[model samples]
Structures are given as C-alpha cells and as structure tokens.
Target: MSETLTLPSHLRAVRAAIADALGIDETEAVPEATLLGDLGAESIDLLDILFRIERATQVKITVADMADLLQGGIPDEEFGDENEVVNDTGLTHLEKVLPQFDRSQLTEPLTADGVLGLFTVRNLTDLLTERAAAAGADAA
Candidate 1:
C-alpha cells in the first residue's frame, strides 16, 4: 500500500518552489526530506530555490538565515582541525539546527561536509513558515 504524505500548505508551497527552481517534478522533491542528496540539488540550485521561494511565498530569505538555522550560531572554536571536524560541542550546537534527525546516526568524525548534507526540504519549509508568521504578526 502506498501512503500519501500530506504536508502543510506552507510546506507544499515551499516544495513546489524548490521543484520549480530545480526544474523537476514536485513529487521528486519529497517533503520533510533532505534537498541535496534526496532531490539532487547542487550548490548552484540553492540560490535559485531561495529566489523562487521568496517570489512564491513573499517571504525574504537570506543566506545568513540558512546558516544560522543549520549551524545554530555555533562559533568556529568548536571545529577541531583543518578539515573542520565537528567536535562534541559543535555536534551539540548542530543538533539544535537539525532537530529532525538523530545526531547518533551521524557518521563518525562528522565534518562540515556532513553538516551541509543535513539541509532538508523541511528546513526550507520551516524558514518560510517562520518568516510568514513573523510578517503576519508585524502587520497585525
């Protein structure tokens, strides 16, 4: 049996925006899932996605917002070596950014590369949702 996923309106809109930006079908952009690995999104696609999302949702998103969301404002001191390996303290901060996934499941010697892999469709949805809510509140 196939189970259909019912995403919130904001999530659906965000997914559609990402898909449109990537020139892919909406079904391929799974909700609440990673964008890069799961949806074949390259670094070049991220800016396009952000632009499309802003146009579709009327919510401005910045790279700093994404960075803060993914890294939880974690300082650089948490990284150990030249590879930017995440130490335990860094992992703790990363957990705040990626509450959807279990940190225990992360590969050993978690690096900056691994953290980049954690960016998901849900993250985009959450960002848009929060921005929309804040805008609404401000207008009220």
Candidate 2:
C-alpha cells in the first residue's frame, strides 16, 4: 500500500491474502481499493482469499457472510424498489455501516447489484477482524 496502514496483525493478514490471491505484491492491496473492481478480483479469487484469511487469522468468512454484511439483513424487496434500484433504506444503512461509502460519487438509480462494488479491502478486513473478535469473546 502506498499509504502505510497501521492495522492490527489480523487486518494486515486480510490484505496479504488478497494480494496473494491476485498474484500481486502485498503493497498493491490498499485498504480503499475495491477488491472486485480496483484489484480485478473475480468470484473465484474471493473464495481463495477468504480461505487464506481463515488459515492466517482463524476467521472463517464465507461468501454469504460478505453478502450479509453488505445487505445488513435487509430483505431483497426492502433493499430495493420494485424496479430493483436501491431504495432509501438500503442507502441509509449502507452509508451508516460502511465508512468507505461516499454518497457524492454515486449517480442516481444505483441498482441492488451495484452495492457489491462498494466492497473494499478495508471492508473485508473489518468484517474478518470483527468476526475474529466476536469468536474470541464468545470463547472467553
């Protein structure tokens, strides 16, 4: 990463895994970079990256977990309008939960499918680290 990230070890592991999965140097995986878009990660890369994260951090995050984090448990109908455009409720929740979401950059009519584009390196790291913390707390 060009900007040095003072992240916890587990969070650093997320970036490392992403870089490895994409066959790029570790420094390329900036936190703000969107894995699917900026890093050119496909669906298969995500699975490999997640598995690597699990091995390194002991936090097993499935694809469904990432989807759930993005959707915030909002039902499909509630997340989007009848036209399948992201509704106000979805927008509000997304902004509140994801620090990376910049409302200004978004054009209108953001479809429900487009939300996945918001998934960044920081987002994935936060998800795995949060789950790892929760698992530790549960064990304690």
Whose lDDT is greatest here? 2
lDDT of 2 by residue, 1-140 (tens): 53337667865898889888999987788888998889999988989999999999888999899889888999999999898898888988889878989677787778877788789998998898799889999999
Error of 1 at 122 (Å): 1.1
Candidate 2, residue 134: Cα displacement in angstroms equals: 0.6
What range of 10 consecutive residues in model 2 has the weakest lDDT sum?
1-10
Clashes of 1: 0
Worst lDDT window (10 residues) for model 1?
1-10
> What TM-score, computed on C-alpha atoms, does each candidate reach?
0.84, 0.91
Where model 1 places Cα greater than 4 Å from the true spot, the runs are 1-6, 79-82
**Model 2, global lDDT:** 0.86
Q: Show the colliding residue pairs in model 2.
A: 1-27
Model 1, 25-97: lDDT tens digits are 8877776568778888887788888888888788998767887776776676654456788887777777776
RMSD of 2: 2.4
